[model samples]
Target: MSLKSVSAKIFAKIVVLRIQKWANNPIETQQKVFKQLISEAKNTVFGKDHDFENISSFENFAKQVPVRDYEELKPYVDRMVSGEKDILWPGKPLYFAKTSGTTSGAKFIPLTKESMPYHIEAARNAILCYINETGNAAFVDGKMIFLQGSPEMQEKNGIKTGRLSGIVAHYVPAYLQKNRLPSLETNCIEDWETKVDAIVEETKNQDMTVISGIPSWVQMYFEKLQKSTGHKVGDLFKNFNLFIYGGVNFEPYRAKFENLIGRKVDSIELFPASEGFFAFQDSQKEKGMLLLLNSGIFYEFIEATTFFDENPKRLTIGEVKTEVNYVMLISTNAGLWAYNLGDTVQFISTKPYRVIVSGRIKHFISAFGEHVIGKEVEEAMHKAISAFNFSITEFTVAPQITTSEGELPYHEWLVEFDNTPENLQKVAEYLDSEMQRQNSYYLDLIVGKVLQPLKIISLKKNSFQEFMKSQGKLGGQNKVPRLSNDRKIADALVKI
Candidate 1:
């Protein structure tokens, strides 16, 4: 083994020991984090506004601060963007992770100096944990490629601002810099399609042993490699054994990926976002990710079923139960207080707090982790049909993940038109264009060829009503969901 691989194995064991220390005392570790957050930010603007100085317990903190989404938290973020300091966190943030928002056009999520290291460490620890468990650190000696956005960041009021992935690209460890693939110039290419092509050219002949990216995007890269060299990804990089992914559930894309790579490889699932890096797959034998309780985040949970109810009970880690879906609330070191993360997760193991991301709190479809919400689709439909004289009665969308060989998956929109449009294909194009404009993730998937433009399926008149009637609710408050990640509703609509 190379000296680097030997060093990595030694380091991995040390990190795993630290992780086990906190994992064994999860609740106590969380309580410490909560107290520190309150104590440190008590003098800041948000803390002062929420009366954080007088708060002595979780109950008091909950009473003082209400759970807020991006729309509700925009006032403070806006000030931060305009160069205001100490508005949210102490002094100023190190960076702003700009992401597509539902109500707000773009969301600027703060990344503080105090909290930023955790993001890098959590990802590193995930790999280290695997290495420590499996005694496989040889990948450290070979090339690693992280398919990500442009590392070039723009300055917004003297603070660096860019995509979360782009921001992370700047922080890659110095030790691994030599082994990382796709030259800096290639990584800075703005167009994703061109970037992927450049990446394939740059890494195809290298000793690549670890590949990291969202599964859909990685599949695109794998397809390109296979087309160019007439070899599976595994054959192209003989030592490649680890696949690191995030954003969406891998099961949907697992078969496609295995087919492309020509074999199964070990994989790690991460729970990360602009808000924080909350969890990572810590074991090869586990079903869920290990939640980072000791990180600079305080957690709360409200049962997702009762989230719409008035004054829903916010439970702490000690109170959460296994197998129950709860909308996650977080008060992080980045200065978000009782922020609604919008993700629903089920605790598979409350003992050490391992969670599986269930779905978003809103009715939506995220088969590729595009997070296309109901409002965006409705607005897109309105824009798409603005030039036409016809209107659709009702519509619902579902992801069509299962496809024939060599065909990409797509969103299947079932629509009951008031009167059938003259050219249905033209309408589909307009609707797809509007969706791409509204959701950046959806746009990326389209441009990357990971998904085809959404396909519109026409439904006969009263199809929705007839389906609802069959379900014993013809009318009166019972409504069809606008979008689903699964195809149950779409199948029923097709059958009707």
Candidate 2:
């Protein structure tokens, strides 16, 4: 083995050792992490405001600090942007990670010198854990491509600001830089189509061993490479053996991706956001990602079903149970205190604390009280696709509430198809049935004649892509919202 591979194996072993200890007693590890985070920030403005010093326990912390969403925390974030020191954290943040803002306008989340390493370390440990589990360290010796956002950043109030992926691109370890692909120049190109084309030209012949990106963008890159070289991705990069993906569920696109690659490869799912790297798929045998309990983030959960209640039950890592959907709340070294990150998750394992990303709290349809979330919608779509023997490029659902006097309200789906099925009506019927199976509220509405069966609107090729491009969210950590309560995105797709 080469010296580089030898060193990588050593490092992976070290990380795996540490993770083993952390995983053995997750509740204790999380408690210690929460205490450390509270202690570190107790002197800051937010900390003092929330009486953090007297917060000796989780109950105290929960009682003292009210849960806040992005909008609620905007004033402090705005102050940080305007060059305030010790306003949130002990000092000004090193940078801000800009979000695509599907629910709200653009948000600039803090990335501090103290907190940034957590992101890097968590990602590294994810790879290390995979290596430890599978004995696959050879990929480290070959070229790896991380199809991420541009590294080029804009300055705001003396702080560097860009997409989290772009900021992370600037921090690729010096040693691994040699094996990374898509030259920095190509990465800096802001336009998605232009950058993807450049990437295809640059890495088409390289000995790529690992690839990482959001599933949709990676699929696009694979398609472009196939078109240019007239070869499957596996044929072009024979060493490609691992795919690291985040920002969306991979199951819906798994079959299509297998076809594109001409074979199946090992895969890892990550739960990284602008806020922090929270969880990762640690074991090949496990269905969900193992929560990073000892990371520089303290986590809390509120039952998602009653999230909007006047007084929701806030549970710590020690209190959360298995198989219940919960809205995630986090206190991070990045200076966010008891912040609701808006995503919902369900724990599948309580011992090591493994979770699956359920959906976004805001990305739901609740018109007429028939609530439906992204998970249910995706599940329904998955069944429909399988039953129809077809594949989808992308899809979104919205509630069509306004109708004529005689018409009932219904759900509308805008789907971009990779393989259009012969019978769309039957596909729509199956989708409706699957949704009813997943959500009893939806089923009751259908049975009561309060709502009509879901409608499927076939989207032209690249319809969703055009819409994302128009919204300045074409690539890199941006995703089309899966379910919307309103017709804003649905209307745009129809117009397209």
Best by TM-score: 2
Candidate 2 Cα misplacement greater than 4 A, ranges: 102-104
Please identify model 1 stretches exceeding 4 Å from their true place. 364-496
lDDT of 1: 0.85
Q: How many residue pairs clash in each candidate?
A: 0, 0
lDDT of 2 at 251: 79
Q: Give RMSD (Å) of candidate 2 vs. truth.
A: 1.6
Query: Which residue pairs clash within candidate 2?
Result: none
**Cα error, candidate 2, residue 460 (Å):** 0.4
Q: List clashing residue pairs in candidate 1.
A: none
TM-score of each candidate?
0.77, 0.97
Which ten contiguous residues of candidate 2 have the minimum total lDDT? Answer: 97-106
How much is 306 displaced in model 2, in angstroms?
A: 1.2
RMSD of each: 13.6, 1.6
